[model samples]
Target: MPEPLQIGVVVFPKVTQLDLTGPVQVFSSVPGARVHLIWKRIEPVPSDSVLVLTPTITFADCPQLDVICVPGGGGSDDMVNDEEMLDFLRRQAGAAKYITSVCTGSLVLGAAGLLQGYRATTHWSAMDHLAPFGAIPAKTRVCVDRNRVTGGGVTAGIDFALTLVSLLIDRQTAEAIQLRLEYNPAPPFNAGSPDTAPPEILAFMKERIAPFRQRRSEAIGRAAARLG
Candidate 1:
């Protein structure tokens, strides 16, 4: 028998809890998977939602993980300029079997220079930011480019995790897990995407996120310049 699979999910202030927890739940269900919630320290962290997550490991003590995942939210903006976090990711990604993210987490991976030349996806509003890191912005809910995998928006984490499990273990195992979780998705509204939303609704959504988008653009400019 071999060692259990080690999985690490990056936890941080204001991270969208669902983005982190959805995939964490799926991976934890794997037979030999051990998931670690990691941050700079072991402490309770708040999410954009009402949820509070606890980091179980510190970067200094974290073992090499089979998968290193960063989940996203407004906090992702803070992480773009976090040198320590970026350094840790760059180091871990150098040898991790899979480097991945959920939603805006890809922006953090991009900030760490891990997504360069890789095709990736993120929250629809922020997907354009990937270009600064030399990534091709994939227009799918889940995008996989070799060892790099990324998912779109918060709800997409479950789908991304299922796909990852299929690759890491087996399709049969993944299917069984999906069935066990009853992972069928049926949105009540057909407005999950810009293509499906009403024109006015889409415009309002864009307007709502404009300030964050502007800040992210500035942060990405700095992050990309540092990549040089």
Candidate 2:
């Protein structure tokens, strides 16, 4: 039998837990599908201050992937600036049959120049930076451009993964997975996007993320200089 479709999920220190776990749960649920938690090293990596996940493979040991998914969070700002990480993303992206990202993962793709001339979406907070890499920033829940797929925000990872499964397998399979999860969402809050968020919620989120934005700006600056 042919090798099962291998999907690789890259993890790093301080990665948002949902970004990795959400997709892992979805893809792993599929029969005949394999998912690998990969990292720069084999040592367990911490997610925020609470969780540690042992990666299945390290950068030096990972097998070639059919689908590569990059998750996003605070760690993404650092990964976007790392020469090794950017180089790996550049190469893996070129060779993978499908390349996908969620939230700020699009930022990593942008840093590698993969999003140039593509219409992409990302966590709204970081969407502005796409233009620097020549991408047309989209304001949607998910955006698909040929072999590239990107999702918006943290929760969008689940939707992105399901969409990918639909793309890879079929809509029936995707709907079945969603049904199994009972994924009927109904949040008490009416606002998930910046435009729909209340003035106070938007203000609070911006203020909280200001430092991260500044650091990301500086890091991307350096990465751009190096790329030049």
Candidate 3:
């Protein structure tokens, strides 16, 4: 029998639950795949929302994984400057077939120096932070650069996972999984992105997230300096 495909998703305090859970849900459908929720410890971690996620394995005991994914949220601000977290990611990137992230998780990859010269994407609000880590930011929802795959924003994780599924297995399998999940998206409103949202709504969102953007920018600066 073939060995199980090991996939590890990093979990941390303040993670955007959807960012981690969406891809996990898709990955779980892959035949012979073992998905692990990883963290510094095997304990509960609170997300940006009310959700609480528990890590299945501690970072110290995590097995070599076929794929390693990082999901982003406000918590990423702390991780960008965290040597321990960055070190773990760097070690995993050495042998992992794919290094991927969802939402602001790409920022964590960038912090770890894993994304140097890779074309990647992150949450729209944090796109500008990519260049500091030597990543070429793409405007698309999912950006794939060789072995590096990054998804934009939270909801995009599902789309990103399906894309990765196609590469890992086959388009036929990915399509079947998509159908099984009934993954068609038809939002009641067209206010998903800044470009498509009404001017007022966009302005309001930009204003609302200004503090977070500023904090992330500072963290990016520190992470880049450390890389240098």
Candidate 3, 158: how far from true, in Å? 0.2
RMSD of each: 0.9, 1.3, 0.6
Model 2 agreement with the true structure over 99-142: per-residue lDDT tens digits: 88999888888888888889999988888888887789989888
In candidate 3 the C-alpha lDDT for residue 120 amounts to 97
Clashing pairs in 1: none
Regions more than 4 Å wrong, model 1: none
Candidate 1 residue lDDT tens string, 109-197: 99898988999999999978999989999989999999999999999999999999999999998999899899988889999999899
Deviation from native of the Cα of residue 69 in model 2, angstroms:
0.8
In order, how many clashes per candidate? 0, 0, 0
Distance from true position, residue 24, model 1, in Å? 0.7
> Sorted on TM-score, highest at the top, how do the candidates line up?
3, 1, 2
Give the range of the ten consecutive residues with the poorest summed lDDT in model 3.
212-221
Candidate 3: lDDT of 137? 92
Q: Estimate, for each residue in 74-167, the C-alpha lDDT of model 3 and write its tens digit.
A: 9999999988899999999999999999999999999999999999999989989999999999999999999999999999999999999999
In angstroms, the error of model 1 at 152 is 0.8
Residue 46 of model 2, lDDT score: 92
Assess each prediction's global lDDT (C-alpha) against the native.
0.93, 0.86, 0.95
Superior candidate under lDDT, 1 versus 3: 3
In model 3, what lDDT does residue 66 have?
91
